[model samples]
Target: MQFDEVVYRIRIAAGGGLLKKKTKSEERVILKGISGMVLPGEMLAMLGPSGSGKTTLLTALGGRLGGHLAGSITYNGKPFSNAMKRNTGFVTQDDVLYPHLTVTETLVYTALLRLPRTLSKGEKAEHAEAVIAQLGLSRCRNSIIGGPFLRGVSGGERKRVSIGQEMLINPSLLFLDEPTSGLDSTTAQKIVSTLWELANGGRTVVMTIHQPSSRLFYMFHKVLLLSEGNPLYFGKGAAVLDYFSSVGFAPSVAMNPADFLLDLANGVATAESNEDQAAIKQSLVNAYKTQLSAAVKSELDVDSSLHTPTNDRKLKRWSNTWLDQFSVLFRRGIKERKHESFSTIKIVQVLVVAILTGLLWWQSPVDHLQDQVGLFFFYSGFWGFYPLFQAIFTFPQERMMLSKERASGMYRLSSYFMALTLGDLPMELVLPTVFYAITYWMAGLKHTAGAFFSGLFVLLYSVLCSQGLGLAIGAAVMDQKSATTLGSVIMLTFLLASGYYVQHVPAFIAWIKYISISQYTFKLLLSSQYESDQIYRCGTNQTCFVRDFPSIKTVGIGGRGSIVAVLAMAVMLVLYRLIAYVALMRVGVTRN
Candidate 1:
């Protein structure tokens, strides 16, 4: 693999976040004229501090970086093509695994999604088992990859699990971003040893490492040291000390070579002030460009004998068909979400709310028309906010994992989306059904089977709309706190316009009632229970007009005149999801 003349930059706003003026974005250079190569069966380690361009260079080599990047990267004699993509794997610094899934389960699902279609499901499972043994992870195969709140695998084991995921496809070329970060020295050594072994197996491996120990540092066949986006040294790991020694910057005392090199890259021990430090840095950079540039440049220079790079390599087909993708994703979604959606705290919250509402409105007579309308309106408001808040975090929580998988071409975005919207039917409906069962009979609004089922259907329909709206908002914002605040505002507006709060309103805002879902649901629930000509006894007289009721008039319901309301909500049900799909296209499931 080789990358030549790699350059990258970005444009950032000069003004503050809250500034109102249209400030011009300032251009900032990130990686500056980076160029290097690693042959097959060689393990290359990139050494740098926090702000250096190690990751940017790695991403560019992987064909995953975008944003004013100018470079030519090729594997063998071929350019970055579909065939190269299929044969390459990238492991990010953060572990994006589901905390609830066991290590065995994690790899098996990955294999099922990524392995060639020629393999059967049983074959995929066997492949996962082989990877477990190969990575020395068999002892912890059944352990859950835990998170901040859950404990299952150790830090080193978690990192291995991430590597195993990429290994499941047997990729020939691999790029890893700081895989040994945050691990103890012992664990870090073991992790690097694993990479060394993999490279020795006739595969090319490139990784960015931070602060490796002496033992870990020697495991790399080659090393590239970077500082402030500039290359300082690129050569054999064993010869770096000698090269710096010849240039009058070698370590003054015995020290880990990695530590000594880092000190040199940062202009350490050679400066007395910040200006001196900058002068020292400039001297080393000048030395490398003059002494080392020719050799590396010739290695990367064009050769007419090499095959011309092209993207014409036929891409491999996905492992599963579209239908099969949906089936597998749907099952996996259920397993991953069951514990979160059906936690004891959430179950108790719904049950307690239902019991309280039911007991408050227990067995009222038919003459109590106003109280009955209030009860239905309460139901509308509760379900509107309940389902909306529950769904507002689904996409945001999975944003990282979704991006990683999509970039890897694991599954079709449409298939994963269908699994998301359809697979939640059973889980999302469980508590609502329970809430209805507990509250419907306890409150004496309707007793007949026809009235009962119709009201249930309307509530479920409303729930779907509310949940779709949540999904749209979540995808659009992609921030938990911001989405939550927006959800609260939207649900509040719908509640205020539900017709039970105010009968008469100004002409301009009166149109809010037409768009409010709560108004329609409240009106439908009223029409299902009471007829237009129904009479009641009020104020010592046995004659009261139901049509003249203020709440009923605002919702505009009279004698089955709510067909438009039902249709509007149906449109909203599909419309919100379409909006969500478009927003997610912009946010969640993107590939570059």
Candidate 2:
């Protein structure tokens, strides 16, 4: 891989969205005409201080960057393109695995989604096992890759799993971002050494490192050192110390060369004034321009037409078919969510809430129109809010994982989105049933089979709609706390406009009732239960109970309303999921 005259300009917003309308914008150059090359068998390490643009440069090289960037990058002397992107692998700084999946299961699922379509199930399984063994994770192959609430693999093992994900593709070029940031010194060295070995096997590797020990620094064949977005040195790793010595910044006895170089780049090498540090930085820049740039360019300069095509046929858009991707994601999703979906604590919480609600509205009288309306709306508010609050965490928690996998072209985002909807449907469908079974009879709701089962269907479908909305919120925000807050606000808006709390909203916002799932659910349940003619006295004030709610017809709670309510839920499901898919596609390899 080779890049020349690479430049990137980032527009910095003055003060986020809260800024005044007429605020002037500013532009900061993150990368400034950076140029370099990596041969087939070379390990290049990018070292620089924070904000020095190491990660930015890595993203450009991987062909995954967004926004304004200008550069000419070539692979095997041909200009880089999507085909080259497919032929490369990038492991992000953070490990993005499903915490609920075991090490082996994680790899197997990724392999199924990413491996060539020609590979059979057995072949994919074999490939996953090989990666497990190669990463030295055989002992913990079946252990979970846990999160904050779970305990499973060690940090080093998790890092290996992250690397193994990219290794599964056997790409010609690999890029990693801070692969050793949180690892122990020994583990850090092992990772770099493994990259060196991969380079020896004729696959080019590029990575950014924060601080490396002397031993680890030597593993890289070439080192690119940047200072304030400019290359201070871009040449052989071993010759870095020699170059610094020639520039009169030699390291003291027993001092690590990497540390010395960092001090020089950070403008703290000498104990003199700030003016002296500026002078030193300028001198280093001039030295590279005068002595090294020409040599580096000569080594990488190649004729554009000298390369031959590697493949003669067209490449498949995806390794797995859409259905295959869906089925795999479907099964993997179930496995990842089984514990949380069916856990004893979650079930207990549902039961407890159901029992409490049943007691609150227990033995509701059929003659009291107000109680019936209250009961229906209570069910609506409870089911709608509960499922939405829980589902809000779904996409936000997995946003990073999805972003990384999708960026790698593992599977179509549409397939994953559809699978996600299907996978949660079963669990989502079951949980509402459990709640209804516990609360419906206990609350003395309409006991007839048609009334009971129809209400149950409406309840389940309404909950599904709420879950879809939650997913959209999570995807749109891509942050758990923010999604939670937004979901609460949305559910509250739906609740207030549900036509049960206020009975009549003001003319200005009455239109919100049409969009609230709770309103439809409440109307559907009311129509299902009250279509019967049986009636009793209402507090000795009347013999019939129809006078209490005169707005039923006006609110559209009739036979047609029942059907429209169900259809509305279905429409919301599709609409919210479509919104989620688009939001997910726009999300990148990392949260903003």
Candidate 3:
């Protein structure tokens, strides 16, 4: 309910890269024993200029700072636990929302995963609606969150929604980073006022503000003035002017408190005596330290007697509920997937490619033998690319949403990994089916119902394999641009390595062919075509024509190997999914 004592001390300095080559001359101490406290129903504003360790202090308070520090933070009368970390909510600078989802859908999905399972669907929806109303987002609740290509919610409403999501967990403490960085003065004041109301409702709110307007500045119950990570003041906002006046400067009524504090910390106008400034700084530091130490010690003593045992029992109980955890995660994943475009462009693309292939290899009375080889190569080669492309584009988009949800503890990594794999099936089936139906008949392959179904199955399987590859790559590299580039390179390498065009590359490169999803898919398609051609000949001309196509003979490894290849590709997909999940989990855990 309250942060009894929060101490954030940071040691930052330039260090060497791998091999210990010196990168900079000396180390710098950014924050030096900065400490503050927030009681229940209190709003604290971290006010400082740029690069003053405002955000860094918040990170340290939240146990997100991956830095060396010498301080302790206590929630109430005990050291903060991992449960506190899980319960605490952090609203980041960017409002990371899925552009396709409406505000209501977004909140509903978050509630389903984060709200206790004891709540019914109607209860969850009711809770979500209440939060939306509280955040002043009801007007835009049903509107879509937009991206560069689409029009949706406005920036201010989006920001509120971001905060609303954090509030959904009903956390006792909330940390926000620059909540009004780019907003207009009026909008910024509104946001700050909303935060004030939240704090008044008993949620301890702490946030960093760079240069808030006068109205916005006056809203804070307490202000933490920091300069290069050193605390100047950490008390009542009204006391700031009096403190500055004591140091020999009278602040004008119109002068912003934020500016007045920055000037004092950075030493503006006439520079004060070094000894005097140092003494003033030391006095404030000691005051905070004493207060924090007492609070922390008191909290620790109480926690030792009252909460530690129960905390362990709670953790043990939660650990046993894996099924419950997975169900919540699966539901969230389904919601996220439903919002994606699934690329209508891709569907159209598959149809176009199918029609082109059909036209290029249209059936004829006098079949040129070389045409069979070419058709076999084309079908195998292009179909192999399907899975690769699908994975590359789709997975990157999903990864962004996944990262946000994963951080919020929507579900476990494995649940999302499975749900995404299954969720993609419907879209995956649609495009590949369209491609196969058009290309199969157009290429003039023997069209017995058996052949048609067999080719469709092979194509669909290949596409899934490629989707797996893309998802793996996307998960491994969190950045969309980097993932796309890496995926493209890998797909290209696989395409060339598969024995489609360069049939007899060296034995050393032969290993690539075995692992390549395209290799098996191409081979299977060729075998299917050969088998279908032979069947059609038996039915139409009453003669076996399998020996007529030389390419079929060269595809000599037989259908058994091709089946094994498909299975192997599927296995590789599973492995990639596992690897992706592991990588993503590590990322989520480490991210601040």
Question: Judged by lDDT, which candidate is best?
Answer: 1
353 Cα displacement, candidate 3 (Å): 2.4
In the predicted model 2, the residue pairs found to clash are: none
Q: Model 1 clash pairs?
A: none
> For candidate 2, what is the total of clashing residue pairs?
0
- The reply for model 1, stretches above 4 Å from the true place, is 17-23, 270-275, 301-313, 558-560
Could you tell me which 10 consecutive residues in candidate 3 have the lowest summed lDDT?
312-321
> How does each model score on TM-score?
0.96, 0.94, 0.84
Candidate 2, position 125, lDDT: 87
For model 2 the TM-score comes to: 0.94
Candidate 2 residues lying further than 4 Å off, grouped into runs, are: 16-22, 270-275, 303-308, 539-542, 545-557, 586-592
Stretches of candidate 3 off by over 4 Å are 1-30, 265-267, 270-312, 315-341, 364-366, 393-403, 532-554, 557-559, 588-592
Q: What 10-residue stretch in candidate 2 is worst by lDDT?
A: 545-554
Ranking by TM-score: 1, 2, 3
Whole-model lDDT per candidate: 0.85, 0.83, 0.69
Q: Taking the tens digit of each residue's C-alpha lDDT, what string does model 1 give over 234-338?
A: 888999999888877867678899998888778784333344767777887888899877778887765646433445434554657888788888988998899
lDDT of 2 by residue, 1-592 (tens): 8888789999987664555565667999999878888887899999988988999999988878878999787788776655666678999998988888999999998888889889999999899999888878999998999988899999989999988988888888999999999999999988888888889998999999988999998888999998888888998999998888887777655677778778888876544435577777888888888888888778677765645465524776678899999999999999988888888998898899899988987888776567767777788898898888878898877777777887788887778888888888888778779888888898898779998998898888788889889888988888898888898998899888877657667899998988998888888877777663445575567675342354353455556667777788788978988887777767664322
Score candidate 3 by lDDT. Answer: 0.69
Model 3 C-alpha RMSD vs. true structure (Å) is: 5.0
Model with the higher TM-score, candidate 1 or 2: 1
At residue 482, candidate 1 shows an lDDT of 100
